[model samples]
Target chain A: MIRLEDIWRTFVMGDQSLHALQAVTETFAAGEHVAIIGPSGSGKSTLLNILGCLDKPTRGQYFFDGRAIESLDPDELAQLRLNEIGFIFQAFHLVPRLDATANIELPMTLAGVARKERSERARAALESVGLGDRAGHRPAELSGGQKQRVAIARAISMQPRLLLADEPTGNLDTHSGEQILDLLDGLNQEGITLAVVTHDPEVARRAQRVLEMRDGEIVRRISADEVSDANPIFDRGRVGKRP
Target chain B: MKPEDTFGYAVNALIQQPRRAGLSLLGVVIGVVAVIFLTALGEGARLYVTEQFQTLGTDVIVVIPGKTETTGMMPGFTGTPNDLTLDDAEALLRRIPEAILIAPISMGNDTVSYQNKSRQVVVLGSTPAFFELRGIPIARGSGLPEGDIDRGANVAVLGKETAEELFAEENPVGKSIRIGEWRIRVIGVNGPRGTHLGQNLDLVTIVPVATGMRMFNRTSLFRIMIELRPGSDIEAVKEKIEAVILDRHNEVDVTCMTPDAVIESLSAIVGTLTLVLVGIAAISLSVAGIGIMNVMLVAVSERRAEIGLLKAIGATHRQVLLVFLMESLLISTTGALVGLGIGFATIHVVTWMYPAMPAEAPIWAVFSVLALSVVAGVFFGVLPARRAMRLDPIIALSSKG
Candidate 1:
């Protein structure tokens, strides 16, 4: 679960301070899949960053799983990211020097997991993403879709309750993007809360709920159940159907 | 995280770019090598000079007619010229209880000729005890005779090199050679004992002290060398000798020197000089430290994305700093180890070229070089690592995109 109250993120440009997010307040329950949709410079990524605990709000209170995010120190916030929150960036952000398995194992490695368990779990995570044969490939050696899958595997490897994806399939082709979305929807069905920020309507349609934003304010909210049959192929998505 | 695993990551990072790593470490390598080699050189020179002083017998003491203000040897500058004669030498042997033997030496550089081959040479005047006191072994015939120091015997002994130069391997004993203004018969040849302290022992010619005194036309002897009985207090004998000579000369004009004191002072002067050289060599290490700092700054700036990525993966600021710091630490320490081996190899090469050069590095020199390299690493590695630690993760990561 996550809660926000009047979150304001400001940026100083030259002599003027520009407010990227102005008095934004929102909340979401556990296991819910939400998509934040906006054009460029609409504060969608900024809101996601605040939710992921990667950055602090300029003037706001953020609560995650009953703990106050503003009260946590930098290291505690980092711990939140390491254990409670999993982030999948648009760029994939796999350490270029590490192989896919090592990339997937990074969060657990930072958590001081033993080498044997880290590798075993990383391999299992890779197998879950259908990357069992590509565990040894580095990011530069993998395709765009494969890289995003590895990033997804890395995010979910530590078994975090909340997954935050900021345009995770933005760099990939449509087929790969659709497959990634299907994978995300399947994880949400298994009761891991998911949030995705996207410019694509197809991605927003797959989320159980969608928030539309412009000019640093959330302007609309919609539910996929209310707009059912928007995409028939994803209607069958669930853990049991995939396995 | 486990330290072993963390450092393993650092090692792989260095290994990924071996050439870059090696080039950055070159300054440390050169610095450590210079430290070892220069210190060895200084130590070697000290040893060589000390060995040369020790070549003359430890039991012997010299009474020179001078007042030396600085070092003990070389008695020219402020000396009050007076008699420290054969009589004074004999008086020490008679009056001092520790006096066992004495040799009064008078020396000059003059021309010697044989079979139209003439060379300018150093002619020494002393009693037969000079050869024994100085450890010059006779290769052929015999050295100067006893009681003949005052006899003014027209007999000469050729150095091995002098004899070979004058006669080309022919036996020079009983042969006549012109020394100064007198024609003397050669009675012996000194063996090859190598040069000592830059003095050419191979070009020496020895005759009776009276002959040398008369030939040089000198009234006072150049120096009086006295030998003490074993285990005798040299200071006591030196006082007595000084008392007798000063009693005669009516002033404290003569400088008394124990052979060991000369050796000690020689090593002390050389040791100080060597320290200066080592200090100079240490400056190069500082320069190398600057080079390491420059390379590390470049590495940190170039790897900003990597730093942000590490922070994103939950690495702390201290951890980011340590990764960059490890890069320099590994470089300097590894360079130091390599330089040590290279330094000793250089010493071997030098020793081979000049056998008289005792090019052995002291144990402390090797250890000091290793410690210095690590210190340089820490000294220069701080700034760049701090810069990396202070980097904003969001800015760093996004900047790369």
Candidate 2:
């Protein structure tokens, strides 16, 4: 579970004070599939970053599993992120020098996992993302879809309690995007809390709860039952169905 | 992290850029070669000169007229423009109790004729004790007798080389040889003393001092070579002799020297020359160290991404620093080994080529070279390694390169 109480984040850009996050309070319990949908500069990514412990809120309290994250040191925060949270970036920030397996095992290695066990777990994760045969291929040698799958494998390698994906399908083709969405859905079904931040309504529709934002503030929250699950596949053939 | 693991990573990183490592090592190689080669040359020259001095016996001292500096061209005569007459020699013999033998040597270049053969040679006039005093011996026939010296006899002892050149297979003893004006009998043939420095001792002829003075008729002075008694320290005897001579001559413008003091002065001059050579060699070493520094800086910049990735994966800043430092150290140490091999090979080749050359690499030179390589590595590596360690991981990961 994650909790935020009156969190405010501001940035100084030349002469102006820009508010990135404005006194927001929110909570997400375990096993929830959530999406924060907003236009650019609406603080959706900022909220996700805060939840993943990548950045700390300027004002107010953030509690992850009932512990105050604002009081933690940089090394402790890194440990929290390593042990309890996994991050997936839109650009897929994988170390280019490492092959897919090494990239997937990176988090485990950082956590001081035994070499043999780290390899075994990384292999299983890659298989889950359907990239078992491409374990030894570097990122440059892989396709866009395969790179995303490798990223997905790396994200889930540590079996973290929460998954934070900041536009996980933004750079992918429609089919690859659908496959990535389906993979997230499958992990959600296995009871891992998943938070996705995206601008696409279709991506938001796949989540069980959708929170829409405008101007650094959440404007609306829609439950899964309130939204129609109409298939957008017939409307846009380019946006294929999840496999 | 554990030291072993850190070392493994450092080794792997160095191997990844073999060309860069090799370039860095070139600096160390040049430094090592300069140190070893220059020092070997210095040591070799010193040994060669020392052995030449040793060939001249250590117990002998030469007393020349005039101060040594003032008598540059006339090293064997006093500056007063008067001969060191036979009376001076006799007076020195009586005054200096430490003097066991005093030889008044008169030398000049002349042609000696035996039958129809004639050759230019250096002729020396001395007493019978000259042979024993100067460590020269007769290899064939006999040396000049005391009677020959006392009676001013017209008798000569031919040097080994002179004997072979004039007489060939025939004995030269009891044969008449023409000096400048008079016919002198060849009483004995001298031994084979071989060449010392550049002077050939075997091409000389020895005659009585009185006969030489009468035949040449141009001597106001002669060189007084004194041999001290056995078991007496040469320095103490030299001081006593100098005091006795100064008292006899009223301490005016006279110069005396022990062979050991001459040798010491020569060694000091050689030692200064060695230092100058080492200084010139150090210039090359400094250039080499600069080359290493430049290459290491380039490596740091090129490996920025790898450094960031390592840091992101839990490597500490200290580990990163240590890795780069170790890479530099490895390169320098390898270069040192190569340079040492080259240095020893050069010494061996030179020794083989010139058997008479006494050049050798001492243990201290080898150790100093090794230590210098290590120091140079650390000195050139620290700057770039520190820069690499201080790089920010977040910005580094964000950069495209």
lDDT of 2 by residue, B41-89 (tens): 7788777777777766677777766666765654544346345556677
Index of the highest-lDDT prediction = 1
Candidate 1 regions with alpha-carbon error over 4 angstroms:
A225-243, B55-60, B70-74
Backbone clash total for model 2 is 4
Show model 2 residue runs off by greater than 4 Å: A1-243, B2-5, B54-60, B68-90, B101-130, B147-192, B195-200, B203-235
Cα shift from native, residue B244, model 1 (Å): 2.8
Give every collision pair in model 2.
B65-B78, B83-B220, B83-B221, B84-B221
**Tens digit of lDDT per residue, candidate 2, span A1-243?**
889999988877799888788888989999999988766667787787678775578898999999999888767776776677877767676766678987887777666677789899999999999988999998999988889889888878878889988788878889999999999999999989999987566687889898776667787788755444452311221111110
lDDT of 2: 0.76
How high is the TM-score of chain A in each model? 0.91, 0.91
In candidate 2 the C-alpha lDDT for residue B169 amounts to: 99
The share of true interface contacts that also appear in candidate 1 amounts to 0.31
